[model samples]
Target chain A: MITQKINKDNITTSGDTAHYTEGLQEEQYLTDLERQAIDHEVALVPYKSAAVIEALKIVQHHRRWISDDSLNAIAAYLQMSPAEVDSVATFYNLIFRKPVGRHVILVCDSISCYVMKYGDIYKALQEKLHIKFGETTSDQCYTLLPNCCLGCCDHAPAMMIDNDLYKDVTVDMLDRILQKYS
Target chain B: MERPLTQYIHPGCPPFDIREYEMTGGYSALQKVLKSMTPQEVQKLVQDSGLKGRGGAGFNTGMKWSFVPMGDSAPHPKYLIANADEMEPGTFKDRLLLEGNPHQLIEGMILAAYAIQADVSYIFLRWAYKKAAQLLRKSIHEAYAAGLLGKNILGSGFSLEMHLHTGVGRYMCGEETALLNALEGKRATPRAKPPFPQISGLYGKPTIVNNVETLCNLPHIVNNGAEWFKSLGNGSADSGTKLYGVSGKVNNPGCWELPMGVTVRELIEEHAGGMKNGYQLKGFLPGGASTDFLTAEHLDVKMDFASVTAAGSRLGTGTMVVMDDATCPVGFVHNLQHFFAQESCGWCTPCREGLPWVEKLLLSLEQGSGTTEDVELLQMHTQWLGPGNTFCALAPGAMEPLQSALKYFREDFEKHVALRRCPYQ
Candidate 1:
């Protein structure tokens, strides 16, 4: 397991103070393991905005999306203000600001894929999933997103469902692939 | 004919399968690396192979592996990243390798992971590489099922776990540090250097970031030995084969693996089948959009790292984007600039602001709406924004074609500025 260092003096109990209020609220947000990790690291690193972002990466990797409490915990652990963490998280497209579906469907639409009718693939996926790009289904089964390219120009019109990629996709294949996921 | 470096690619044969690849001694290198050589020995062999990084930067591969500190006192986990993010314009070589011969990349990755003492490796692919990603994931599963990956590979007590992490399609993600950030689930923006990816990368652990082609050479180097590999190319220092991706006005626009030090003329005439429709060749972006342009006068120049640099351009990815005489130089540069501008990632001030400014200048000049002052402004921006100014190599790379365009086709640009519209247009 990775080690973390924490500082006791920086911890405060004043409810009126914004830092203390955020800290008090964030304390409950962390998983037991995350809390322990934060406690271990909080004393040594000086908890800057960058550290908050880093912590968010770890949290999101485990939880798949950042909760407000998790964000506050990240801010507290990094010895940063929660607002600082929230701002950075919201700025980048990589961060999952809201809950995402279990499976991520990425359709390739770069120049080569474009020539190969990747737009049709996207439409097929949208129809099958009943969700537009960047929207999770009501059932939370799938989330569709358009991508620039998946680099297999030879096997154009491709989509990735989670980590596994399905290449040379057509409308027919899309139905089969979506059926399996559903 | 002399022995072809890429004898595997037949003219009319269907893409070779895993079975055919195995038949032609494909995994033989992986077996050799696993059975005979220790990880340290493999590193030494790669160091001796004189294999440089194929991903633009040309850093020595063997030397790069040595940078990772080993032993229990060092970092607990080390990571190996296969930079499959081939977003550089005219560079489609990695996509071919991933689609055509993924097992070769798998074998290479296994050897590299072993050498670096990394337990986990990730192929950070370009978002545009969906097909390649699919092929690679399937190959990884095959390797895992065969015990070539996962715990105790080939009963050698060495274990590796490989993952395929696809990018969201940004040119900047090709930068090693930015690639690392993207892998760790951040916005795909280049990171500040000092702590280069080798020392601190991928979940803040020691990482070795290698190009797809560079890693693919590993099994071959380990199997055939360094001396034999060195003899294939012309220069004593330059060793092994390069997958050359040729594009634009050439008669044949495709990728071909050739020995290093082959002349540009040979590549153009023999491999590329020369210019199409009897069109006269003007200039070429010798290695993708990043390198300086090479004119017909430099056709005799050898296509190697050192030779290209001496002739005033880095041999970046060996992607030759050729241009013909009928194409207006101003318009071509404008098109390229537009790509650079759109894909700038908008992270830094100069790249976000300067690139579009350069594009506007180029467009105005191409449309005959500018004076000579616009040309000077373009040159100034190109000089200011490259190398030292940026957080990573992307902005510097974006400047290569523009700088070279201004230098090689100043007269054409001047003509556009003077006439207020291109003659060809």
Candidate 2:
């Protein structure tokens, strides 16, 4: 369980940009579980930020998208400045900064997928979801996005919903795959 | 299957269990190395085995280890890294080895750590390989429980701790220095060489970064002896077997561990079961997308590091992505260009600025807006961005398929300009 207490202030300033931070309380701190996980990773490596991805993953697992408060809190807990944490977070393509849907679908359209006809599956998905790439559905259930090769090229035309991988996906298979997510 | 390198892999079988691995003489090599061999003896055995790095560069693996000072003279708390971040397009060979038998890799790492005299090791894996990661974690735990990992491994007084580090979605992280940077919790960018990882790496200490397949050979060399390893090669100095794969329009695309010097034809036709119906192979990226395209006429070229290089291409990763005559060469190159552009770390000017322009030119040619000048520009860009001109291999590798496409498929590029669109379309 998260044991960190929240400060009661409403406004948080990030890099000269002041905004109302939502989803997290004013005084943001790592939950005991998140802290313990980050500390464990830190103990393994010589430096703190070496565990940046794993730390962000724990925070993001709790909150769908890392809010500014959560980002600052993670940096503080990991002994890194907020800017350092933010740069690391933004550099990784997988870590989401903006609000994402309950489930994110990453369709790979790199060379192998392109050769294997990723267009048909991609088009079918956009039509069914009524949301183009990078756009979440009105119900906030799904957000479709494009990914580079997911290293499942042998089983071309692949996508990942959350952590599970679906490969050799045909135009007809997208619906069944997406249905399993919701 | 007779070769020690691939004896353990069986098609369609579940991941080999620890008992099954041992039943076929799995940890025996670890036991042999730990009990009998000195770290120097282990290093000399690898050198005599003639094994080269399998992750495209083909550097001498034993020589790479020899660069690090070992024992009392060597730096304390040195690191050994297993480069498992397999992100090259069309290369799934590492995945096969990692997923098929995790213990082989674990045993290999133990041997590698023992050789380098490093107390810590890391499996820097690609994030998408969740299954492989899970298997590695389980195997590491099993090895630890069995006293194969952690302190006093096999009661030999050699202790090491292994960790699994996953990179979040960056193709650049596959580069050894960039991988080190990513491991250090920074943006995945390539560091300049000369203070190579062998001398100064991972936290400014001596380190060794080896590919998954390269390290897997250690046990076989230890168990069967170096001369035996040398003889396993298909009559080449490049010893042992390699994990070769075929994908893209092949009838049965998959990976296999074959002798080091298998020909391209044997890999594509015999192992991959040939191209699919109605798809005559026009050409292929003999390695992954980063390699130059070899036409159908070159199918008999040996797929070893030296032979492939002698035949005008590197045996990069030894995996082939076939290009069927039915597919438009212009569109194919365009698709690959998009990947290189997106994956470019944007560090160097040539890669950061040039790759996207190349992609733009190719996309224009593919989509009917290409001029003759666009072809000329792409021709110029390929040479401008070739290897030695860029900071790392990514840009040069990015240019290989494009440059070769312009060479062999010149008519295809002309047709796009002449027809003002993809002629195949």
Q: What TM-score against the true fold does each predicted structure earn?
A: 0.74, 0.94
Tens digit per residue, CA lDDT, model 2, A14-70: 542222223233224667787787788888777777888888888888878887777
| Per-residue lDDT over B199-233 for candidate 1, one digit per residue giving the tens place of the 0 to 100 score | 78877789999999998888778778898778878
> What ranges in model 1 sit over 4 Å off?
A1-182, B1-6, B9-21
- How good is the docking of model 1, by CAPRI class? incorrect
Error of 1 at A28 (Å): 20
Model 2: how far residue B151 lies from native, Å: 0.9
**What do the candidate models score in CA lDDT, each in turn?**
0.74, 0.85
Model 2, residue B128: distance off in Å is 1.0
Count the clashes in each prediction. 19, 1
The regions of model 2 sitting more than 4 angstroms off are: A1-27, B1-3
Candidate 1 lDDT score relative to the true structure: 0.74
